[model samples]
Target: MITKEKILENISKIRVNKKITQKSIAEFLEIEQGSYSLLERGERDLTIDRLLQIAIFFKMDIVDIITYPNKGSYNKENEEDIKAILQIELKKDKKDQVMKLIFGDNSLEILNN
Candidate 1:
């Protein structure tokens, strides 16, 4: 069973691996730094949307995030496979929509480059 503590531990590991700070994540999520600290410490409850946002920000699948063991490492191959699958599954229009949602008006530039 997945526990909040496990998720928090995974998030902290991922963040550290990515060389990101809690303050950066908090700013991205538009939440207070103290609130974000509580989240990392497993003292605060996370909403589904917030969880999704964090997963997206980290370029990870929600399932992977939830199931990842605290001491385990990230699977780069799996992440690449997921990206390829997304590229294949998302139709041009749908991809555009998703890119717009993720990158706003810079989606085209980001996709093109």
Candidate 2:
């Protein structure tokens, strides 16, 4: 499951890791710093379109924004899958633990990417 706090933290981490300033991100997104700050602080909720733009800017998926798995209106099977992935991603253990739990050997592709 993804929370606003988690989303904000991950976004901040990505920005810092990439050595991109908030102003740079704003320029890329063509949004004002005030507006961007609100979004970062979770004081403003991003529309789906805006969210899509942000994800594209970061080369990330919607999954990264989600701090927690949300079953929402999904069917039982989908809900179960989300739950499983959440457990795998959230569980803190050795590096291989996440890979083994989430995708078994399928994470090899992710590593290469």
Candidate 3:
């Protein structure tokens, strides 16, 4: 079963990897830093909306955050499948916007060329 502790651990790892500070995240969430710290330490319960916001801030799926520190091997195929589904679900303009943000204007140029 997924635990709050596991989710927080994943959030911490992702934050560190991305060089994002707790204060920055707190600012984004419009919450007090202490409250954010409490959430990170598992001292406070996280709401689903808050979790979703965190996932969006990290540019990750909520499932990835909740399923962190997986015991088994990573499932690349499943991840790819999910990505494919998301791409199909998103509208063309929105998809292009997301792709530009994730990649860059140069990526769009490459695609067009």
Question: Please, what are the lDDT tens digits per residue for candidate 2 over residues 1-113?
Answer: 55667777777777777787878778788989878888877788867777777778877666654532342344545665673333424444565677866778877687779
Q: Write the per-residue lDDT of candidate 1 for residues 1-113, one digit (tens) a residue.
A: 67778788888888998999999999999999899999889788887898899998898887777876432356655775664333347888998898899899999999899
Ranking by TM-score: 3, 1, 2
How do the residues 1-113 of candidate 3 rate in per-residue lDDT, one tens digit apiece? Answer: 66778888989998998999999999999999999999999898988999999999998778877876452345666775664334256888987887788778776876777
Q: Using TM-score, give the best candidate's number.
A: 3
Q: Give the TM-score of candidate 1.
A: 0.58
Which regions of candidate 3 are displaced past 4 Å? Answer: 69-113
Worst 10 residues of 2 by lDDT: 67-76
Top lDDT hit: 3
TM-score of each: 0.58, 0.51, 0.60
- Error (Å) of candidate 2 at residue 53 is 0.9
